[model samples]
Target: MTVPGSAPTPPDPFAPARLGPLTLRNRVIKSATFEGVTPEGLVTDELIAYHRRPAAGGVGMTTVAYCAVSPEGRTERHQIWMRPEAVPGLRRLTDAVHREGAAVSAQIGHAGPVADARSNRLPALAPGRFLSPLGMRMTRAATAEDIARVIRAHAAAARIAVESGFDAVEMHFGHNYLASSFLSRRLNHRDDAYGGSLANRAEVALGIARAVRDEVGDTIAVTAKLNMDDGVPGGFWLDESLQVARRLQEEGTVDALELTAGSSLLNPMYLFRGEAPLSEFAAVFPRPMRLGIRLAGRRFLHAYPYEEAFLLPSARQFRAALSLPLILLGGITRRATVERAMAEGFEYVAMARALLREPDLVNRMAEDRDVRSLCIHCNKCMPTIYTGTHCPLVGPLAGPPAPPLTGDGGRPRPHAS
Candidate 1:
């Protein structure tokens, strides 16, 4: 039988694995990929259907991408928010994915200074005033009061996620977001107890994790998407990340840690990799082609030219330090890579781009031993999502597009006209 991607499907990749207290049917996990299907930060039918495909595809677990804990600190206004009003739709999403027999995780976070002020119309807050690599000047530094508010926001979001029927919540502690900003000396230039020293720099993350753990208790699994390195000169490097990871484990605030790298703001190309067709705003501040080419030269620079199980080595380093379950992400598109990751000490292997190319890939890989995933790692899907474009690679098999939102008076209405 031919698989969806037309590559030889490998033998059953669905061997059981464990994440926290939950026992998964297989080692495969559909990593978080932002689809922009949710409307006004609320779960919609399109979002449910988008996730259901992967659940039915036989992955052990699938993580919903980038739910904002604070509306003012969000990347997109249409991104899901874990508020009381959003709980019902989120409950429906959980129920639908559960029926397909796959566990689900919701990734919760705040964008901090990375949030687009013009788009969201909200003031951005960061650890300290600094220039964004994107060229936007940071407006303000987060105060003690602001820190308290954001910490509570995370806890509140975690509570809502658990109450809404999510089986797990993954904290976004990477990619130069709030937690990562505080952890990196390059970004956090404060003299307070929350910065200056390594221990101080990690205080915010530790506080947020503790609050989430306290609010959710032992009911829902809590994992963190952590950056192994920020991939910039004088950025958050492996040594500091290891220290922070050890501290988090000691505090008993996290169940699993997924190692990732690169700062989305400082190194967008590195984070997503490849040419992202310029959107209106992205074009407003374009980097010179020569600078882009220079950044792309480093082997670890961009996300393109994917290699299987790319993050395993860093994960292995972390494994030697902590006994917590480790999740290895990046470029895992085949069964052999998955097996190799597990053998190298990764408790779980997460695939984002690969699964986007073929949502039914896990099932096909499970059914035959010759199937290879079809993802070209072109990174086209990354930018297309901002424009509300569905994954062209999988959209045919997935379904029709939902109504497009109109450009009506700053309100999100279906694109009509």
Candidate 2:
């Protein structure tokens, strides 16, 4: 039944694949979902155990989530920020994952408008002055000095990643973080070199990426999580995002691009389809903010019906536009979906909630092609980032009983990636 001279099939999802200088054992990457175990901004035994399970189960790469370049860049004070003192702990984390035959990537970025300034005791930065609901204050607009410093911080973070034994560094340029905010026409209303035209707006992201690549050279693979769309009105759309993708390819700034959507600042639920846990979210905030959430949470946490490979439709656009390797994210939970992604030219697939639901999901799928994930997409896990990110249905896995549910939502922690 072979057709003569026909093109060969794409590589199997479970087979090895090259990413920059590193060859991952498979094409599945555990996308960065902020692990809430770090209470002191350093790696803890819990955090190590959190990633170790997924690595031991089966994933090409397990990403350490939202490691800020600077303390203020963190979404919450307890989040990890690259520092000399942190290297040893990070080394231990990387070693544990590597021992399981999986590569580990550190996701680095500034939270920008997403930062809970109140908790961090530092002002959040944005392209323009804007209101930060979490902090209940206005964000500070970035100056030229702040911009330069942030770009340099990204390079420094990559250097730390190399020292810490991370095989790859995923620069966070999506989710309405500092760089992403600059890319948004609605969020960025500035008249400087870092704003205005799309080219100008992209300077922050481009500078950081190039700096990271230059800092690490070929010592570590460089990847970016980019937004194909911001999923908000008057925001960065697919058309403009493709242009940015082309520029990144033209400059060879990244080895691969992981396409994602949704703005953590405006619409967090757009990226994660299913029920929005409004009550759980409101429980985590202060009473006044809790009231505010009851009034406006629905607008921010809009729900979309769950479906396998929900992001594929938009990701297909990027796949057609560039020859650069692309990682398709969002709603990837089945082996068939992985096959579909590879068959359609995507070099890799990234999963978050499904893996949180079952760290061994990938290994299970590898054993049986007919296997489907157990994640129901309830979104209950969304609020657990404060205590520990885990499926509430499996209470024991998340670590530490999240204190008795008080009338004010059981002592909520700060919001983060």
Clashes of 1: 16
Candidate 1 regions with alpha-carbon error over 4 angstroms = 1-13, 131-137, 273-305, 394-417
What C-alpha lDDT do the candidate models reach, one value each? 0.74, 0.88
Which candidate number would show the highest lDDT if scored against the true structure? 2
lDDT of 1 by residue, 1-417 (tens): 777887444333477766666778897877777766665678877789878988998888889877889886676467777789999999999999999999999999887767655456666678987654332445469999999999999999998988888889999888888888888888888999898989999988899999999998888889998889887788899899999999888989998988888787666554554444333223322355335435443432334444566666666789898888788887787777776776666678787777766888888877876788887766656544544435566563445343343332122211100
* TM-score, predicted candidate 2 vs. hidden true structure: 0.95
Write down the TM-score of every candidate.
0.86, 0.95
Give the alpha carbon lDDT tens digit for every residue of 1-417 in model 2.
447897658779998999999999999999998887777788988899889889988999999997999977988777789999999999999999999999999999999888877767889999988788656679999999999999999999999999999999998889899999999999998998988999999999999988998899889899999998888999999998999999889988899999999888888888898999888888876677788788888987899998889999999999998999999998899999999999899999999989888999999999999998899999899888877788888873748333333332233233324
The Cα error of candidate 1 at residue 40, in Å, is: 1.5
In terms of TM-score, which candidate is strongest?
A: 2
Query: Clashes in each model (backbone N, CA, C under 3 Å)?
Result: 16, 0
